[model samples]
Target: MKAIFSWLNKPYYFNPKPLYKLKISIYHGLFIFLFLYIFRPFYLHEFDEIILPYTIGIGITAFVATFLILYLPALIFKDYFSEDNWTIGRNLLLMFVGVTFIGVALWYFGEIYKEPYNLRKINLLQFLSYTFLVSLIPLTFFVFLNEKNIRLRREKKVKEIRELKKVQELNNTEKLTKEVSITSENGKEKISFCIDNLVYVTSQGNYASFFIKKDDKINEKILRVTLAKIIAKLEKYPTIIRCHKSYIVNTNYITDISGNARGYLLKSKVIEIDIPVSRSFSKQSLLRLIS
Candidate 1:
């Protein structure tokens, strides 16, 4: 049964398609036919004339009929059981009863014709032996086949849920890294900035503008506080180092600090903005940038 399960799981490794599913079914079917042929065994001894032809014909027709009979249900019921959103016990009971009815149908048909093929002429011992070999073998194979599909579907669903959880976790982490702010009478107030996002604060008389970093994007927001007040408020944050009287910069964003006669340039952003770094503050800003 474990080998059967392994083969079914990797059908492509065995035969690329379900057409080849007949291979396993027919192999098992032939085994049952041979077992019954030896045990309860049909005898051509009763047919004196053309008995060989009769046996050959019966063998071919029975092989074809039994192949379609037992194998079709195995494939079809395995497919149905793959949709297993129902009780396993109920499905198993239904399958058992259905296969039992098939065995009874074979007995009924055998009984309809007298003597030659009449099941009534057959002794109880032979009938029971034949029924066990023909019916029970195929029925047991189908039960195992159905269970394999059920297990495969369960494994697939578990894998899909795990992948969904991974995607959801990634989305949550991305959401946390995005800046969210509120605009009110107090001016734009940021609840948080991604640790790597601070850029520079610029004066606009009584108001100040905060420049923040994004993914190759720059966002600026006007705050109600003056640049001096902004500097005082951010003083405790060691990264906020004054570049000029009008600008308090997040020194972490200072890629290069270039100084010339006219003024100093802060060269992190696309546009190299000139900042009038005072003699007193320039030294401190440069030291902070290197640190």
Candidate 2:
């Protein structure tokens, strides 16, 4: 029980794209439709004369209702369902609620068709309870599989980073005596620092802020330059890589490489925030650069 609870509390994958949401809704909708039409549950088979027509309409109804029940809350409460904080427990709760809503929709359809009340209203709470129960087991199984896959992927990435560690260490060692310079696009501003001491650079409207470590203290320097121009010059130094759209981090300064529901994140002691690894960036390249 404790192990299950811990696993459910851990992060689960989440994608914000409308296409991704649409796919999920479609999948659940199809499942409900197929299940209703094929099994004909709740005395659906007893209405021999009217059964065929009822099944056809109800199946379509289930499809549409399931789509709305599963898709709407995520669409409307997007912030509450962000990838960073989404967990398997929350997913389970959402599915449970969605299943309840599906039951309500199916019942209302039954009433509209004037289907026999062989069972009480709420079907004695059977459809919601039984449908959710049946689906829960399989859903939990798949969630476990997905969790394992994610952990394995994270572990593989860690190994890749470890394999590339020596190269980054060597580069950082050499940088202790070497200096790197960043010149603004307009040629009006420039900043230089011992390569090892430079921590990270972040893009601000038209300026770049450089974070540097000197004598155990952190310092910041700002120059009028776009991150694109800075990265062009910094590209020669493989250790300094752009982990996020607005942030470029020195591999030597990255103390942690972790992942949440969305994707990889880079963390540094000097920097207070976790830097996201956008889908636009090749994770393989980042792994190769970081020790």
Leading candidate by TM-score: 2
Clashing pairs in 2: 165-291
TM-score, one value per model: 0.33, 0.71
Candidate 2 off by > 4 Å: 1-5, 47-56, 69-71, 115-124, 164-196, 201-211, 219-237, 245-247, 255-262, 267-276, 279-283
TM-score of 2: 0.71
1-291 in candidate 2: lDDT tens per residue?
999798788877766676766677667666765676678775556666666666666666666766676567778998778766788888878767766777677667877675463533446377567666656678878877887788678667756776666455453445445788888778876899987788888887788999999988889999999888888887877677887778888888777677544567777777787776765556566674354
Q: lDDT per model, in order?
A: 0.51, 0.72
Stretches of candidate 1 exceeding 4 Å from the true structure: 1-192, 269-271, 282-285
Q: Which ten residues in a row have the lowest lDDT in candidate 2?
A: 115-124
The alpha-carbon root-mean-square deviation between model 1 and the true structure, to one decimal in Å, is 25.3
